[model samples]
Target: MLVPRQVDPPETPAKTRVLFTLVFLGSGGIERSVCNVLAGLNPGRFATKMFFHHRPHPKSQQDRIPQHTEVVWGTDAFVYHRKMLPRFFWRLIQEARQADVIVAGQEGRAALLACLAGKLLGKPVVGMIHFDWGAFSREQPRRQLWGLRLLYPRMRRIVACGHDSAKAFQALVPVRPEQLEVIPNFVDGDKVRVAGEAPLPDWAVPIYQKPVVIAVGRLENQKAFDVLIRSHSLLRASGLDHHLLILGEGSLQAELEALVKSLGVESSVFMPGFTPNPHALMRRAAAFALSSRFEGLPMVLLEALALGCPVVSTDCPSGPAELLEHGRHGVMVPMEDPKALADALGRIMDDEAYRQDLSQRAHRRSEELSADRALRAWESLLSTV
Candidate 1:
């Protein structure tokens, strides 16, 4: 059965309709943050809806949509498939007709689609860039970049998930500086705090007996789980004797498992794909590590800080440095350096005094990304469009 939403607001001039467009909602940071924003927005002034270009997977992470927010699904074909683009475009245009503003839930094809729909329908569009666009361009197709250059400028505003992300996008893309806005990812502090205290899952019980380090992110190349695994092996070789528990599923699962076995850290390393609630694990772990090479402001980092989990992350482009306040809040290590990663994780795991201090500071820093502050920033941005 489809999820039900509240009926559309009575036809009135005061109601500002906002439609969110995306390829699909999967077990990723972007989908989770979008769902959080959808649930947190005030309904009194905005009529909200989410349109998906494909069906959500049964195994994917699910979030609660706003009570009355209508959910629409379009063609199920791959987003980049030529046949799917026109159908997705048509669906977006149809949805755009009823919306005052179109919030493109992600960059790439979805942004391109929303930009096309908004242009043809004379509706304002807002594009959300969730990754480090500068680093992303290296792997993006020339044609897609060309399309982005043409379509992005047409957006009323482009929302970057980090301050650095905004600067990176302006430097990497053709969008004007005036069209960009930096809105860091927001965290549900209360929910994380409660969930962190919840009982640990059965599989994680063994981790409690020994020191445990947890890493959570999609098993993609961008996340660089290979680096994390190597670092974990180094820590084990040095007799750190801690367990590494990685959460989330992606295309690299098999490769990562193979690497773990080859490194002889299979017993110490665990890749439990896509845990529904990782907060409890975060709270119980010795430290939380984010080994991404680039990010637009990782929500997982903030979620860990909210739970008072001492974090050891790569000083990667865009988010980590800013989130860690250049090493004030948490330990920041060089990207792709297994030795440096091992040292940082070792520090957090071996030094109880240092770890507790970092945790206390991190918890305090969590206030900066609290839901109330981010919600107001988003509301202010939405109201003007």
Candidate 2:
């Protein structure tokens, strides 16, 4: 009878629940990075939910989101309107209560709202800084800056997409040094290389038939497509004869097209709007170009490197120099300097040996920024926070 004692099995630990909030889930670098992180997370250790202030459009990167994530659209609670902040706030609070940790997918309203909810619930909030703070502050309204100054410090952790971004943020905001963490944007190189092998579309075939320099990003001021267009014109004047392919759609499409016409590079420069796969184009293109005025580690740059495409980028604040390893893996030129960009592009297109060398270096550097490394860093941060 004394030997009949029974013992129960040990209980399993609960998975950490994480809630990520964003203003929208559109086809942007921030959205792509978030999708990658969500997909890379270990399901056994963490459970994730995503909250969007508005419903994603059909063309948005909604399909890229992992299947395991529970997505809640605030549009379901109330139609999104600038005047409906109180309703959105309450809805966010309801969602935040169930999460052990809250993450603002990008800075601005998302950060403010997440910080407020985390404070009220005594939960930790992680705010992401996705742009150079100096450039971002200049573009945002005073109220936005005020809100960030007040709420950013309250965040349990602040993640910057690049080191320069972190430095700019610290100089602008009063957050402690310990609160800041730099996690560069990363790409799944294997997936990128596979996607790069996809055949070019019918329209893009002729463009890629000859030598071409490609740029991919939203056709907006921040991207400085105008600068890229000017650089292309300069290259053509120098008799480089390489076509310019600009991908992605934005409000400034009309303006950029007009610039192309004015520069007399209309026949050579192509604006094809947004494409689901730019990797395919990068794989075949002679060179990849980034003419950004500023960036928070451009994902397109990393994608180009992963495909072993030679890169020529403007030395923009917070990203290009760092991502390119200060001209080791790719060429870096001064921002808005069409001549510098043109010279760099011409060099890559003209010298096959130099281009091949850059290609090898790019591929090697990309391995350092692989998804597996970033995933481990993210898992560590999530588990601790």
Candidate 3:
């Protein structure tokens, strides 16, 4: 049995059973957060059901949903309802009422379904806000349609990942300020290995004595690797010979590769693809870099800092500023500006003393966001619901 503590510290409750349901767990920031929550939740008090979406039969997401979590296949994320709404509801109606509360970290169509099912079964539904509520505000017509179809106002609460996200969500729902809670993404920093000099690869240690400029993210549009490639090109032209090694893979491979070739910096850029132990990589990296167009609080940046990796990231609207505490912990360059990005990267790479200072501050700041602390926050929220 999986159980999570139901009461806040200093107070004890007799008993409470809560079910945390994730309606979508596709590989992304939200998926990562849900995974963290599942892995971090106290198994003695709460049970988790992580639902996945892509052609759900013989589902693979179940394999990753953490052993403590009860992975449910053909669940809401699959939209099995589109094919058999009444029959699907017949099955889910029972599952919805099996706990004191149903936590849905859902977005898009799945959210509407979770809200409806939770309401019909008289279960408290806490809708988790992940990405921008919509392209603009929470009141996007899609939500209005969901409200009309599901009468979504019946759901109990809306949990947001940031202040801006909370505001966007309330713009659509008539939620009180107290009801929209802002909790940022976090990692178990204690588990993070402090970045000490690793035995550098035989070739890299001597040939390129400068700290390796490292960036990690999928090769996707939102990640903006092209911008990083362009910024790196500028950095190289300015005589900063440090090699750029990006870790992760995506469809943008051809375009990004051509950009590297066009910029004539193929020799300086390396893609080692997806790395399972990014924390280990961060430990030995000269610095961590992010050049994203937008983000919902990046997990990799948080992990990098915990590993003592000095960071230089584009000042994307909400995520970086919140994570770096307005550049107190790391360098934040203006978005989409290559010169600004290059200058920041150059400063961090060339100014050894400054980079060291930032690295220490980052590691110290990340220490507070340990898995235990994050779990306690989740515990507090679930207790109230």
What do the candidate models score in CA lDDT, each in turn?
A: 0.86, 0.88, 0.69
**Clash count list over all predictions:** 1, 1, 7
| Ten residues in sequence with the least summed lDDT for candidate 1 | 56-65
lDDT of 1 by residue, 1-385 (tens): 9999889877755868999988897768898889888888988888999998886666655445667789887775533466676777788888899998999999777888888888888999998989887887776778866876787888899888988988888886787777888878888889889988889889889877889999999898889899999999999989888899999898899999999999999888989888878999999899999999899899899899999999998988899899889999999989989999999999989899999999998998897766887788888889997
Residue 184 in model 1: shift from native, Å? 1.4
Q: Can you write out model 3's per-residue Cα lDDT over 1-385, one digit (the tens) per residue?
A: 8798787578554444555554444445676776777777776767666544333434324454679666553433454456655544455556666667777775655566677777677877777776554333332556554562344356676677766556656665666666567777776566546323344455444424555778887787778888888988998898877888887778888899999999999888888665445555567777788888666667788878888888888877457777788888899888778888888888888888998998898878787655676678777887787
Scored by lDDT, model 3 comes in at 0.69
The candidate that wins on lDDT is 2
Candidate 3: list runs displaced more than 4 Å: 1-17, 21-27, 54-65, 75-94, 132-154, 171-174, 194-210, 370-373
Candidate 2 residue pairs in clash (backbone atoms < 3 Å): 248-273
Screening candidate 3 with a backbone cut-off below 3 angstroms (N, C-alpha, C), the clashing residue pairs are 3-43, 3-44, 3-45, 3-46, 4-45, 4-46, 248-273
Give lDDT: candidate 1, residue 144.
67
RMSD after CA superposition, every candidate: 6.6, 1.8, 7.0
2 or 3: which has the higher lDDT? 2
TM-score of 1: 0.93
As for lDDT, the candidate ahead, 1 or 3, is 1
Please provide, for model 2 over 246-352, each residue's C-alpha lDDT reduced to its tens digit, 9 standing for 90 to 100.
98989999999999989888899999887888889889999999998889988888889999999998888889899888999999999989999998999888899
What's the CA error at residue 383 for candidate 1, in Å? 1.8
Model 1, C-alpha of 147: deviation from truth (Å): 2.7
